[model samples]
Target: MKKMYLSVVFLLCGAVLHGQQTPSGKVFRAGAATSNITPKIGTSNNGGMQDITIRSIHDETLARGIVLDDGQTRLAIVVSDLCMISREVLDEAKRRASEVTKIPAANMMMSATHTHSGGTACPVFQSEPDKDYGKFLSARIADAVIRANHNLAPARIGWGVGSEPTQVFNRRWKMKPGTPIINPFGKEDRVKMNPGIGNPNLLEPAGPVDPGLPVVSVQTPAGRPIALLANYSLHYVGGNGPGEVSADYYGMFANRMQQMLGAEGQDPAFVTVMSNGTSGNINNIDFGGKAPDAVLPYEKMRAVANVVAAEAFKVYQNIKYQDWISLSSAQKEISLGVRKPAADELVRAKDIISKAKKPIMTSMEEVYAQETMAMKDYPDQVPLILQAFRIGDLAITAIPCEVFVEIGLDIKQRSPFKPTFSISLANGYNGYLPTPEHHKLGGYETWRAKSSYLEVDASTKITASLFELLDKLEAANH
Candidate 1:
């Protein structure tokens, strides 16, 4: 069945940057490294609202860093096998990396792959970030960047995109009017997430999917692969069964692709980093919940990794090396307000909260009830990190929330660069940022949890801010 699927190159941008010269004669240099980031025993898993356990390692989670330099300017990006990395930890990791490599804090972009099976990061609205694990992950990330900085050699990179519509999809669905479920606001909503299909009440999905798999590959002058980083807008393909700490398909995809595309040399050959794209409402599971044959947990992950990696190899073959390229990076802090419930609704929230003797969130609505009350303690406003990086005609945008595919697609469409993409779960975790229309429809994505707290128009504001930065980067090139 998988053989029947064919993927097309979404977009391919090939250009040169001749801004600076290096001793090696190549204008740009690249290097990559990976640091094992699997959590220690007893660390809490971060996939769900509950505190799930990590009994063992299905596979070692990793923090993969890639550094690119044009002699005069340098920037780094790190992809962690985490569910969601907290703002505090992300900032600290960037700070430490800067101290060693001298890459400005704003020039570093870090993001978790949103692997549900991975261990806890600096969580919001609760206990402090896991002190030991947080430090370990941050230190490892910084070290990886430093190592990549050390190993930097004259290199070349190319960009392209591929499609896997069957493997990646939107999980939001519109339900029948009569079937009403309680939303975070404690009111009925027309749309819901994962609305099972057997119920015949299912309508079309609430949103469209962006199955664009954009890849950026770095290689030595001789064309030996050094690192390949890809961004796909689908959320994780569920974790390794239960009780296992795996990097989910994101890691598996990278590992498998490394073998398929990697050239022989080092023990691991080259690093393969698969970064999660905007997928707040996307996943591999059959959310409509009606499939003739159900795929086993690990099997589904392997299938996704195989198909995606196969497509990436195809993109890899098309990229030709460049001797010189320009690099630029910038960051900004966007102020956003946490969404609040109405005054009278808060009374109802209190009533709902009073029923529970302890904090045990069962249903989705109950999860919001607890989170809504917790926001009373959160500052009225929060700072979100928005960043952009330019590699010739390719532009990268970093947003700190579980951004929906619509916003990502909008950025790509409106981008001045030929090939552009945005990454979510970078720099901070603020939950889901649905488009304005989805907020009005009211679904699980718009629900108030540790994940989705920003104001209704946050999607609009953040999108605008990101575009503004991209404009600056493109203008500077001129």
Candidate 2:
């Protein structure tokens, strides 16, 4: 009886030891030539389109599979610098990666920075492409996956949040009493006299700004930082011109972080990746229209990018490293139906199309037109992905779409996990996921814009699904 009891003790000890083992992670910089790509005209800035070259560029975050105490699943995260990752492309990438690495398709979460100035717009959405830009991007992104798999190493992880108020501003300005503005139809209109003018009235004076800059620092057991992933929601619009193909503020921010950390020798084979949060209605420019005397320029964008990066470095210094952890990830697809164009709206669209002047427009304009037509035809069928991965105290909720700030706040408010980072524009960019109320306002985001194809209710439904997934993951963890 004594011998049997000793053997049982040994077995239990081994199980505990196995459960506490740290999972490995890897970081790799998949550099590609993305310069010479022009900004999609008519969407944002049309400043005399120049041939812009990429400076500091976008990156991919590839975390290896980590099995948590549950011992039944694994998780991976990939961050890229593109306008948005489409479902088709994401599905293909996952399928390919799984074939190569045996990492299940559902176990991985991929997101883009939503940088307007990056390579050609994704072909899945944009009907036309600038030369071979799409092909180049697809190949380069795949390379990132392969490289990350090669660089896997045993590392400790730490997470923390910090804030920088001056770097980002709420672009949606509330119209003050007596403020004058032109209507979308070119008629002069008086600014509403109500307090709701210019403000995002539904929540409060302003929506919850994720000043909580979530940072994940990976380091070797020797305490050297190897890579850092930081997430924020402010839209990337530092440099706005046709010729410039930069990573906007994201690139500059990453470079600044590297420089700051390098000074302390804390920078590990470092790559600072800026994952964009839900920023569908966010922009740096608050165009009060009259071409104000002082406009924020591209150079100002670079400066702000550096400032944001500096703020991230401040948070990085405070992270406490931990090694004993397990990892598990789950992803589910929720179906989102498209908004059909109203009967009267279809007639109006037909009239507008008949009167449109340009016979030859750029690919960007064509995409915009196509999305509008899609709204009039079949309701778009889109897949909403809710993916979650837990690494000790750090849990990442990957949501699809350009999520609004409110949604992210809502997730954080109810999340059972501490430091649960919500990443938007992940796996696929179906379009702007606006709250149900925003849909009623009938603004650009809520409308059938060229880039987005879904209705406003889609955002709310998707957010609810995400929260559900988080709740389940948290329960499983316990």
- After superposing candidate 1, which stretches have Cα over 4 Å from the reference? 1-26, 124-128, 262-269, 287-292, 357-359
Error of 2 at 443 (Å): 2.1
**Deviation in angstroms for 200 in model 1?**
0.5
TM-scores of the models, in the order given: 0.91, 0.76
lDDT of 1 by residue, 157-221 (tens): 88788877877667788877777777656588878787765758777788889888888988876
lDDT for every model? 0.80, 0.58
Question: Candidate 2 has what TM-score?
Answer: 0.76
What is the RMSD of candidate 2? Answer: 7.6
- Give the least accurate 10-residue stretch of model 2, judged by summed lDDT: 27-36
On TM-score, the leading prediction is 1
Query: How many residue pairs of model 1 clash at the backbone?
Result: 5
The root-mean-square deviation over C-alpha atoms between each candidate and the true structure, in angstroms, is 8.7, 7.6
